[model samples]
Target: MTTTVGRISLAVQLLCRAGVRVLAVAGSANQNWLASLGAEPVVYGDGLEERLRTRAPNGVDASIDAFGDGYVELAIKLGVAPVRINTVVGFLGARRFGTRSDGGMAAATAEVLAELAAMIAAGELIVEISATFPVEQVREAYAKLAERHTRGKIALRMR
Candidate 1:
């Protein structure tokens, strides 16, 4: 499971707390931040296959493709079960590979949303606020967020 320090990380953290062995891969250098949230952080670099081969020798339970760069097939090639794959990004190869996203089949219920909100409110999860900027400082806010080593969310106050 890969997640950013934004809203998604909160959910991933909860899943990890619920006994899921989450392998959280951050796109930026904030990998250690994810580790602090009880996830195995995967830093981006070379030898990815070797790393994955060592870490997930038994095959992954599922792979969530947040970047949507046709990782569903890549995950399958890595021996993850196809049925367990899901993607938030548009499927570019669905027609060619005949694989559909699992997300499309499920909808978030109000109860689920409330429970998640409760978790956040209770501080059972951590939300990273790396930086915040007013509307007038959009460029600065974007720069902070674009930083490779950012550890959390960067909020832009529009109001």
Candidate 2:
């Protein structure tokens, strides 16, 4: 399950490309986009676990948490093994549950980056650029990021 503005789109794409059935937990605004990437988009908030259970009755084999509020606990409740769960922004939860906190560092090898680059170059992967601003407008860029509803990355034009 994922949360809004958690870069969930990229995760969904990568997982789907790897043949994993992804059930994206995001807000309603992103449902169509997530579905386009082959993820089963489930609206987040309130009875999230029940929603997830309804979607995947067999149980989730693994989970990735980018939107930290107790997602690790939710994943555990859904029966995902702690070893198979990774949280990018849930260090506290990872510590409490023994789940892995493998974010960019764990998978940021040059080869992996190059592979992703190649995919993007070949049009096999789409990197959504929600907005762009000049470097001088860095504060504005961050302000937009702080809104937590960006559809994709916010790029800063250095040139």
Candidate 3:
């Protein structure tokens, strides 16, 4: 499952565009939102490894490690080929790959955002809201995230 469910929609959209049937690991949001974006949300109980092993027995086509470090290493272990692997922030132990745009990450991020917006406009993606609290409650917000398994985002209001 993704550590940040709020951002996974872009990944799912990209995967769908590439004709891949994606299975997302939604660690903090309703599974339906991901499904609506063309990914099957597989809950990663215990740990990511356990979920990967159970879901992709023959190894995954590719595993992108957005979480970096230990996560990238685990993705490498599960991928069938080197090209089927990469990470947003380069990890120490994994092979580095070029992103879609050579204009650096900012450009790629923009592209992802465009895709997300398009999906939202088309009513193909749904935003999942877990909770919202005043800025003064930031500590409590973090505590709640640490203590429970939420199905969506925990946002702080500034005004």
Candidate 4:
């Protein structure tokens, strides 16, 4: 499971390819694309737990909380052990529940980069580039990002 999956499509793709049943939690706007990414979309809102339970009655083995906002608590409610739950934006929750929130720094090794490169080369990973901006248009690019969910990343090209 993962929440607020902005920088997480690759992880979802990898997990799905590995035969893991992934439940991607995000807003309703992200549902369709998420399904295409091979994940069961769980929209964030009231009764989310009920919906998840209905979909996976056996419960989830682990969870990745990318955007916090009570995601850690929700994972605990779903019977996932704290040790198996990794969070990025939920440091307080991690301290409270003992969920792992080591952040992306630890996974920035060369080996991980090699794996990502291989996946991209093999067409197994898709990184969506929403738009590209020259350095002069940096402000405009940021304005676009502030709009939220451009459906991809905004690239700034250098000369």
Best by TM-score: 2
User: Which of the predicted structures, 3 or 4, would earn the higher lDDT when compared with the native?
Assistant: 4
Model 2 / residue 97 / CA error / Å: 0.8
Query: How far off is residue 77 in model 4, in Å?
Result: 1.2
lDDT of 2 by residue, 77-101 (tens): 8888899888888999999999999
Error of 1 at 46 (Å): 2.8
List pairs with backbone clashes in candidate 4. none
The residue pairs in collision within model 2 are none
Which regions of candidate 4 are displaced past 4 Å? 1-7, 136-148
Local distance difference test, candidate 4: 0.80
lDDT of 4 by residue, 54-89 (tens): 888878778887777788888899898898888877
Candidate ranking under TM-score, highest first, comes to 2, 4, 1, 3
| Candidate 3 lDDT tens digits, 1-159 | 222212345556766766786767656454766777777677654676777677766557665544443555565556535555555544454544322211125545877778778877887755666789899999989998775456556899999
Misplaced by over 4 Å in model 1 are: 1-8, 98-105, 133-151, 154-158
Residue 66 CA error for candidate 1 (Å)? Answer: 1.4
What is the alpha-carbon lDDT for the whole of candidate 1? 0.63
Cα TM-score per model: 0.73, 0.92, 0.58, 0.84
The most accurate candidate by lDDT is 2
What tens digits encode model 1's per-residue C-alpha lDDT throughout 1-159?
332212247656876887777776555555666777887776544655566667766666766665554566566677765566666553764444555555533647888777767877889877778888898999988887555456667888988
User: lDDT values of the candidates?
Assistant: 0.63, 0.83, 0.59, 0.80
